[model samples]
Target chain A: MLILVTGGSGSGKSEYAENTAVRLAKEEDLPLYYIAAMKPCGEEGRRRVERHWRLRAGKGFETRERYVDLKGLALPKRGVVLLECLSNLTANEMFEPEGAGDRTVEGVLAGVRSLAEKTAHLVVVTNDIFSDGMTYDEVTTLYQERLGRINRELAGAFDQVTEVVCGIPIQLKVKGSSVI
Target chain B: MILVIGGAFQGKKEYVKKQFALAEEDFADGAVCGEEELYWARAVLHFHEYVRRCLETGESPEELTALTDRLIRENPDVILLCNELGSGVVPVDAFDRSWRETTGRLCCRLAGEAVRVCRVVCGIGTVIKG
Candidate 1:
């Protein structure tokens, strides 16, 4: 099963995803895996990683640091896996040394596709960072455009989709309904 | 005035455009332009930015409140679009806190006077007022 959760900065979507994955793991009697996409290059990044570490400290999640190439991740054949975020993954894929030359929007989507196919239950968290209604430079605009398209695609491809606002989760897609 | 709000990239602009037939020229961004020029806009998309500017310029929220009143009085069909209530943890910075608080208050004031209010989620609009 593929679950997509999205929210803006400071939203509790990350915490929500973690808890949801934990619950799914327990319910399905599967091991929980935390896929950390961030490279933690700066102080803020490191602090964020530590904060997340503490959040899932006792939640039984084995962390896998994959800053790029989701397709290369080797997860156990079947288990609950939370791709902690998609934004960082996109940035890394777009600019990281490994993907710099060959990566495209569809390529990133394909990477996520592989992760979904390889996992028993895939819960992905993504950031909805662009709708500030402010125009940006060409590069930022391109990034936002790619992410927006990817988000729409993910929402359609997943079994469930949700958007978290101010710590509240609004179910955008649910099983057996075409509402989202 | 009509208030339409949704999360980032939730198709709020597209919804407004398709629903109200508001062309790009018809809708003005609040992030740019001066205070007086805002009143001249047919529709002010992202009303929060105007409020942000008001706060930044050391203008009182009351001044914004009055301005919204004048805008509504001048243009009976004006529309406002704001990101729905801050749906995340409170900001740590004093300026951010004030901005969020002031934006919330401004949205409420505008909504209070709005003829219709709608919350859009996932391209779906739910009428909260009117």
Candidate 2:
């Protein structure tokens, strides 16, 4: 089961998703995994990552810093995994790595599928990109288009989709077959 | 004054029209904007485009921000429609990033003075302030 949560910057979706992951872990007594998508940078980057670390701290989660090839990573069996964010992951997968040539929508979707197959309950938190209402240069436009496509695909495959705005979670899609 | 906001093509305009009983003639498309154009309009749509246009005319975001702040303040009966741009990922280009920042600042200014603020998502309006 996968739960997709999305919102704009500072919209409080991360907090909501984190709390949801914690709750799910408690209910099922499954080991919790936090898949950190961002690579740690210098002072500024450390500060941002620290904030997220502090949020998940003491929540019984083991942090796994994985940026690409989610299926390649060795995840715990029957554990609940929360991927911190999909935006940075997408950017990393699309831009970084030697011979990263696979920036297409199919590439990201494949990774997500692999993670889903490995985890018992997956809670994925992502960002909403198209709401800005501005068409950008070719590269940025491609990034936005790919992110939008990834989001729609996740919503279609996942049992639940929620958009958080102003700290309020608006349930957008529930397939009725969801247990979490 | 009230401010209605939403993502692109999320029905913010239609919702505002139905709720306020406003017709097509009541709105002055803000893209061809001027002090004269907004003088007596019942409401304004595409105000974001207006800001973008203002930027093209060599005006700074701060200048437009001040201008819009005054416009919303003086026109108590006017209901403004704006797209909430700050909630998305920051743009990569210098120009687009500046536009996004400017629009966010302008919306913040309008939201500060407006009596009501409603966000429309999936055609559902949630009143965040009033």
Candidate 3:
């Protein structure tokens, strides 16, 4: 199953995804695999990610920080896999002028699609940047635009699409409905 | 939707807590709300932790939306405290600019979800949305 979880920052999208994945893993006895796409830039950044990981995984599950080569992870064919985010990973890997290159958004979307096709159950987390606001700068405008496109594309492919608002899950797409 | 917004280190946090306490007192005769402070701390941690996680995992927007929805569901009468990160000059670095923009977007989204929104300035609360 491919699940797409999206929301703005501080909207509780990460916690909700983590909780959902953890619950599913516990109930189904499936091995949970977390694919972290963020790169730790500094001491503060590293500590913050560690704290979130501990809070979500509770100190047991393994975590792999892979930003660029997302397709190489192989993501075990039988368990649950969570791509915590795609936008940041793409941003970090394809930084600056490179990110502005063609196929950046498409490449990320294709990666996500391939992962979903290969995995057993996948929970993909992302941000919903469209309803938030307009981007103020060039780089941000590019990122936001690309992210919005990626989100729309992934929403089309995923089995379940949920938006986390104020820490609550509003299911946007179920088995067969378009409105979430 | 009591929106409590201000810049960093402002008194919005304290004011929100007081308002929460006052509301509790008015409604339930001082019945203590256990999760107010906890939520505030969570909010503070949530901001940085979320950014860090996003940087690490490449997750999407759903995580944030789900979190906010859950919080609102749990406490409809929530007093959200948000930093006004966009009311200043744009940053020179890409990372700094993105951080500011992301936080500003999140705060705006939260205010929209709020039934009542207030901007706290100089320790005084002003309603911005209702």
Candidate 4:
């Protein structure tokens, strides 16, 4: 099964997704894996990563750092995998010298498919970044377009799509149900 | 307390007015209201701007959220209208980044305490919490 979780910053979506992944892992007796997307940087960046680490401190998740080119990576065993987010991954693929560049959408999606095939369940976290109502520079706007496309595509493919608002999960799509 | 949030011009204030039966006079515009006014107002609008103003005046994000916590405790029935600012591309300016992050953190805190929470999109209100 594939799950897609999205929300604005600090909306508690991470905690919600983490708990979901942990439950699924326990239910199926599968090893838990967490894919950390953001590359840690300066003092503030490091602090942010540390904060997330603290949140998952005892969750029994083995962390994997895949900055870009996810399709090339492989897991050691079949288990439930939680990708922390898509926003950072999109940014990395768009700007990172070694990223997929213009091929980000297909590249990331292909990577997702590959990962899903290898894991018992894949839970992907993304950002709800289109509703802020702002116009940006050309490059930033292009990034938004690309990320937006990625989110739409994944939501279509995933079994469950949820948007967390103020720590509340609003189901936008549920598998086999078109009325939600 | 009640929280009404959405993107700019999403009719959040109008929703509050119609749904809650509140008059315009009951709202304390966060853009220009005195800090003291926030504690007693029946409702508040442009809350993101209020967060920006506080940051501009040297108030740290922690201080702003703390102040809001106190406001929630003291005025438990107050209705808050805030823009959902953190859903867009991260800003290039340092201040813009801090402002959005602070506003988001504050909203999370407010939503936790609010008796009702509604998100407005395309002028339609979805009750996410109550």
Q: Pick the winner on DockQ between candidates 2 and 4.
A: 4
- Looking at model 4, residue A144 earns an lDDT score of 86
lDDT of 4 by residue, A67-179 (tens): 99889888889999999889999889989999999898888888888998999999999997786667888988888888889888888878999988777788998988753
* RMSD over all Cα atoms, model 2: 6.9
DockQ of candidate 4 against the true complex: 0.63
Q: What are the runs in model 4 whose C-alpha is more than 4 Å off?
A: A178-180
Off by over 4 Å in 2: A177-180, B1-83, B92-118, B121-124, B127-130
In terms of lDDT, the best-performing candidate is 4
Evaluated on chain B only, candidate 4 has a TM-score of 0.97
RMSD of each: 9.5, 6.9, 11.1, 1.9
TM-score of chain B of each: 0.91, 0.91, 0.65, 0.97
10 residues in a row with least lDDT, candidate 1 chain B: B85-94
* Candidate of highest TM-score: 4
Model 2: DockQ score? 0.18
Tens-place lDDT per residue, model 3, A72-105, is 5575446777887866766754684534356678
* DockQ scores of the candidates: 0.05, 0.18, 0.08, 0.63
Q: What is residue A110's positional error in candidate 3, in angstroms?
A: 1.9
